[model samples]
Target: MKAIRIYEFGEPEVMRIVQVERPVPAPDEILVKVYAASVNPADYIIRRGGNEALKPLLKLPMGLGIDGAGIVEEVGSEVTEFKKGDRVYGVPNYLDGSYTEYLAAKATQFALMPRSLSFNEAGSLPACARMAYNGMVEKAKVQPGHRVLVHGAAGGIGSLAVQFAKAYGAYVIGTASAHNADFLKQLGADEVIDYNTQKFEHVVSDIDVVFNATPTTTVDEALRLRSVPVLNEGGIFVCTHGVWPSELFKGLLAKKKATVSMAGVDVNHHKIFTEVAKLIDLGKVKAVVNKVYPWERAAQAHHDSETKHVRGKIVLQIYQED
Candidate 1:
């Protein structure tokens, strides 16, 4: 089998397509003939060793992908939900490779591919879609009529966040560049702010919740939000990138400071991915695929995602069916 592996941490050049042994499924897992795979920010993060907590788990010359679509080649004895020849897509759990002709996945992380979508579209859903679902629905507890703001509105997670918030009936505000305003609006954002021309705080206020999808950039830009003092009292600010301990917030709470919460998403997506599949099946949501690359060009796929300007998901074709 062929797989994309990273030998060292640095630029996209570090990614290489190499020959590797085919993986076998666990008793509770399934072996899939991969049709396609999608690129996510986490793929690039793992490739560059940015997430230190995750480094110890990665084996050297590690396979670098999370989400993919495929047909079930074999199901483990312990698995009952899936069978050989079933069409599936999922986030592979603790594996040697997803960007390969054959990959293994835990049955828990997969769902039936939506009848309305192709393999490429299903490949684009697992990681980013689960991240967005956990953030918008579970953590933030976004409600209809609530005023919501999504940072990095044109990117993978942010684009889905916009759609989710809209479906839930929130008045959605999104921040992106001039080039993405129309795209953001098309995704159902009630208002799109060109972050380069105007700070989001200047144009919107009384926000009930702010979804910081681009936490890497949001920490520094937090100052830009101070100008807008109209956030609803007791409103929550969810910071996905930062870590805060209870002791760290004790003093701030004593001083009656504004509420700030640090959050981490569960990427397991075992159940959430199923729910997202339902949404796609029902036409309530869709994966936004901005670019597609051949499996051999996994390096270029990582490079494009690193740019941070990619409007939606980038997918890699692993195997083309007739």
Candidate 2:
């Protein structure tokens, strides 16, 4: 089997395709023939050795993907939920990675792929869609007529967040570059604010939920702080990137009696994937795929993801799906 691996952490150039032995399913695992996988910010972050807390988990010559869509080739005796030849999609083990020809992981990590989507499209949904679902449905508890604001609305998780908020009957507002305003609207955003031309806090007020879907960075931290004043009384601010609110931002939330919440997709929960698949099949949600790269071009995909300007998810076609 061919897989993308990084022996040493550095640039995108550090990633390389290498031939390796295929994996066998364990007692509770399934072996999947991967069709496609999506590149995420976490992939690049891990490629660059990750943060101090994540560094200890690093093993040299590690694979580099989180989520993918595929056909099951075999299932272990304990895995009765899936059978051979079933189409499945979800997050594989972080250590195992999904950028490979074959993935063997716990069957509980996957669910049936959406019936209405292609392999590439379904491959893009697990990570971002789960995060969006967690933020909008679980943390923020979006309701009808609620004003929901999503930062970095053109990117992978943000795009999905907008759609999830809309699906829950919230009034969705998105902030992105001028180029993506129309795109955000197409994703069901009720309003799109051009972040380059205007500040979101100055234009939007009394927002019921402010979902910060941007990558965790110094600039994004500042942007997260700016959203504090927009929340309505007792509103929730959801952070999807693991960034906690600063003391100043916390003080502002205190005045409004609002609170900040952190959200992360629980890949082990198969029900989340099943619910997202339902939304996709019903036409209420769609994967926002920006580009598809061949498996050999995994390095280039990492480079594109590092730009942080991609409109949506970037996929790697592992095997051509007939």
Most accurate candidate by lDDT: 2
Worst 10 residues of 1 by lDDT: 245-254
Candidate 1 local lDDT, 116-155, one digit each (tens): 8899989988777776777787777888889988887888
User: Which parts of model 2 have CA positions greater than 4 angstroms off?
Assistant: 265-268
Off by over 4 Å in 1: 215-230, 242-264
lDDT of 2 by residue, 188-264 (tens): 99999988899888999989999888765667668767887788999998888755668888888889899988878
Which residue pairs collide in model 1, if any?
A: none
RMSD of each: 2.8, 1.3
Candidate 1, number of clashes: 0
Candidate number achieving the greatest TM-score relative to the actual structure: 2
Cα distance off (Å), candidate 1, residue 158: 0.2
Candidate 1: C-alpha lDDT: 0.78
